[model samples]
Target: MNAWICNSSDGSLISFYLMGMPFLPKSLFLPVFFIFLILYLFVITGNSLILVAVVIDSNLLKPMYFFLTNLLVLDILFTTTTIPRMLSYFLLGDQILSFPACFLQMYLFHGLSCGEAFILVVMAYDRYEAICHPLHYTVRMTPQVNIKLAAGAWLAALLIPIPAVVQSSQMAFGTMTQVVNFFCDHLAVVQASCSDSTFQTFLGFCCAMTVSFLPLLLVVLSYAHILVSILKINSKEGRSKAFSICTSHLLVVGTYYTSIIVAYVAYRADLPVDFHIMGNVVFAILTPVANPLIYTLRNKDVKAVISKFMSHWSRGYP
Candidate 1:
């Protein structure tokens, strides 16, 4: 009768539903979740140690490390906002997120990312001053000037994502509410909307390019000038010493920019879901984890400070 027909229609809808299926197989969930959890803890602890070391050591209180401290803090903030929620989804097999929660996560994740990009540009400029104009480094990078630059970077990062968020908020959702990835990524969420997404797509593209490419260009130009200055030094030992100081910075910048460019290209081409997720995880999590190790291993002063701090902590605990 009528009841039988209604039950049949419900069964058909469930069979055809695309949004609710698990993207990852059950067998792979627990192992991947644990690995990501361990990586997240390492990122948090390592970056926090760097920030603490910079704050306490009097000798490390220069403008260069000041910028680095801010960068480390941003990395911590960046990873914290995205990774925990992703871990939760992996552990619980639950991907249901309310509308506001998803939007907030997207805004904060991209906002911190933009802030990190701005901070990297500032760090490159700090290196440029220290290497190319050694005599004026102290004068140009004074504490007050550093404060102003840091404030400007934070403000710029926060404002750049406003247009995209506003545009996304206007889109209407039809039958789809499930996002493919673990957390609510802004691009994926926007793509799910039923309304006209042309303007949103264009705005997101422009913002991503502006935030990623512009800082990358600045970093390259600063290092070009830095290399030219380093070559002018007469002694081989002196040139090696100078290059060592900047090598860590260069490695971090290279990893960050390369991963970001790959991700952008993949996103534009409509690549597979797994590819997109992997690219973002590399840029967001792996880059931050690598920053502390690169700086500590490559810089003698940082290593000494870290050793001293660890020894003090060990003695106090014992």
Candidate 2:
């Protein structure tokens, strides 16, 4: 047990002590703080730029960019939910999170994560339609339909984790308040509970499958259809163009799942607790940081728009 956990005479919980980068020496905390600070700033600035580009350019008023904007908003919220507190932990050595604040963090992080997964699925479906059924793509993915799809994803994400969070909140904390990670990750908080956590663990697993793998499966199926359609194109240039359209989204998907797998493996493998902590940290930070970079580099349209936006801003245009 960590030295921070202590007995409560009345068996009630008041706060949680976050163990931020337990493996790092005290002298290195400031450096890690600065590193995370930079990444968080990048995530905010990069995603915000993409969002602004999509908003200002009438050319980007389509289903794909709409979903892209949704994704950018989710990524921004996702990082905001965890990284600021983490920076405080690293910089000021303030690891104490009030009880309600800890659960709120867990709920917001998990909810935004779920929203991003589903938004990716929607993007894949949009790509599939554009590639496999180009004639009907516009009719099928109209603005109202896109609005409904995005709203449904956000609503499901907001509601799906309520049960697990409520159940976990009711579990007996009883002074076992040392959350093993820098953030209030679902499993870490459940484990901190002094009460029975087997059911909570299982519940978290089920929710993970529902939100994570289910969306991934949908994306894979959509891409499979897209691949079949692209293969039917007679001209090599046509095929290349079709595949290029998906490259950025595919890269985003790959980065997202790679971080997830890394975190999952670090937890399930026989590794040190520090590795487990770091794995979750990677999951929290990696995709949001990489997502804008991938889209900006891989998608010519986005790159051009961002470039134009930057030039206009430099010349004092609103």
Error of 2 at 126 (Å): 0.5
Error of 1 at 230 (Å): 0.9
> What lDDT does each candidate get?
0.77, 0.90
Clashing residue pairs in all predictions, respectively, total: 0, 0
lDDT of 2 at 272: 93
| Candidate 2 TM-score, C-alpha based | 0.96
- Give residue 58's error in model 1 in angstroms: 0.6
Error of 1 at 263 (Å): 1.6
As a TM-score, model 1 comes out at 0.90
Model 2: per-residue Cα lDDT over 1-318, one tens digit each: 334444452424558888876778999888888999999999999999999999999999989999999999999999999999989987888898887888899999999999999999999999999999999998999999999999999999999989999888887664548888999999998887777789999999888877899999999999999999999999999999999999999999999999899989998999999999989999999999999999899999999999999999999998
Evaluate residue 285 in candidate 1 and report its C-alpha lDDT on the 0 to 100 scale: 83
The segments of candidate 1 whose C-alpha lies over 4 angstroms from its true place after superposition are 1-22, 268-271
